[model samples]
Target: MRLNAAPRLPWMLGLAGLIPFVATAAATWLAPIAWQVVAIRAFLGYAAVILSFLGGVQWGVAMCRERPGETPFRARMLLAMVPSLLAWPALLLHPLTGAWVLVAGFVLVRFHECSRDGRTQLPDWYQSLRTLLTLVVLACHGLVIWRLAGA
Candidate 1:
């Protein structure tokens, strides 16, 4: 799909959603040392939430397109739940480890989304937007990891 063909609102909202990732990542470096731990926790929490939301998006897609009792439907539903499952454990780990977990989660989701079956199920615009957003999110996670690792 042409880049401009993507709706403006989702793009706007998606970009807006990056605020917390950006802000918290910045806080990890720029905020007072006392607040750094809080910022790290906040970053992990937000990443987990967003990862779950992405899974929900997959669920929504499956619900809208697949018929009940079908193998494809079951498979898609199972895949949809994977992100939330991955995100949950990250919350209990150290900030550096948690950031790496989230990084892997985002990459796995995006990789699936780029697969042939995934490309067929989702809109071209949605796929494009997801790719872009996932890249930025991964970069933010990298920043968090860098900070947490004392780099």
Candidate 2:
């Protein structure tokens, strides 16, 4: 993969990634009703799984649009599922999987977007903010999982 020297990395992709995280977190934390938490987490969990797959399709779009010097990043993008896919099943079976499936899936989608254009086509601000936001989302998911487990 040729290095992208210019501002790349699809920074907006990172921000796009933040949507689910922020939305999920708000639904969980700011809501007055308790069922809202369950509704948000359950729906988001499933949606995250489906969306990651969709994001992969979008990833294909980027790969197809590959510039002359770019390396095929689709393979790397696909591999991000290792954690999420595994966690997803563990979540269903054990319920103690920390529901990391959703978190992993979310990150995979974000990483898929952020890593686009060989990491050079994106803006730096977007990447860092995305990374930060993603981590926060992951942390929130972990907390949610723990809460559900204890209940």
Candidate 3:
């Protein structure tokens, strides 16, 4: 995945996406108790949002085909909703569980996007971006889990 020369938008957005995760992780270590709580909630909430966005990307890609001839539209749409469905429930669980679920969702979706059996067939560059973003997200999530466990 050669995204170095890709459009600046995805690259910029990809980097920007790290902000919440990084901030939350930093807060987990450096912020006061009240602020840490706020940061953890914010991080989990943002994780859910991003997971849904990734699902929507799959939905959009599946629906974008013009001359589609029975491409399992129903199944594709249903599959596209899986991430959001997973995310919503994760929000209701314990913080550790929720973070773990989000990490799982992120990684699972990324694998799907990159796999041949995957629902969405994205460009290599996009896959690369997803990988980078997922790594940062997982790291932040790990930090959250560690902090919560130590608490």
Candidate 4:
């Protein structure tokens, strides 16, 4: 395929990356309630889902005028996020592991593309900040999951 033809790279990559994350996320929910990992997973899962939606919108707007030949980054990004929405409700049974898997893949696509284009590279501290936020979000979700599982 032509270099440009692979423009859907971000969506594909994000989906691939999200698989393991989804698996891990599911485990958090599956873990014996005493493990208390479910809350954290739920929160991360939620944030990841929401952020991906917003990110997709941004990506779509950025490529708004690109010709039909050009890949609609935003559109595909938005499409990639669809799974996340579906996954949220699936949390009922591990919520949306499949959806989160897609989210991870989409994110990977963005991360790789950004690095490849030499455009925007998140700073080390920023990455750290994300990690911290992710942890906190995951913790919160775990609490929610715990409560749900108990009911």
The estimated TM-scores of all candidates read 0.95, 0.49, 0.90, 0.34
> What is the TM-score of candidate 1?
0.95
- Write the candidate numbers in order of decreasing lDDT: 1, 3, 2, 4
lDDT of 1 at 143: 84
Tens-digit per-residue lDDT, 34-147, candidate 3: 999999899999999999998898788778742345655665566689999999999999988999899899988887777774634455578677777888888888899999
Task: Mark the regions of model 2 whose C-alpha exceeds 4 Å error after superposition.
Answer: 1-37, 40-54, 57-61, 64-95, 105-120
Candidate 4 TM-score, true structure as reference: 0.34
Model 2 whole-model lDDT (C-alpha atoms): 0.54
Model 1: which residue pairs collide? Answer: none
Could you say which candidate leads in TM-score?
1
In lDDT terms, which candidate is top? Answer: 1
List the RMSD of every prediction in angstroms: 1.3, 6.8, 2.0, 11.4
- Tens-digit per-residue lDDT, 5-118, candidate 4: 333554355345445444555555566765535544544555556556545544554455334444554345454455455445544445445334434544554454345331
Kindly indicate the candidate among 3 and 4 with the higher TM-score: 3
Model 4 residue 77 CA deviation (Å) reads: 3.8
The stretch of ten residues in a row with the least summed lDDT in candidate 3 is 65-74
Per-model CA lDDT versus the true structure: 0.87, 0.54, 0.83, 0.46
Clashing pairs in 2: 8-120, 8-121, 8-122, 9-121, 9-122, 10-122
Return the clash pairs for model 3, or none. none
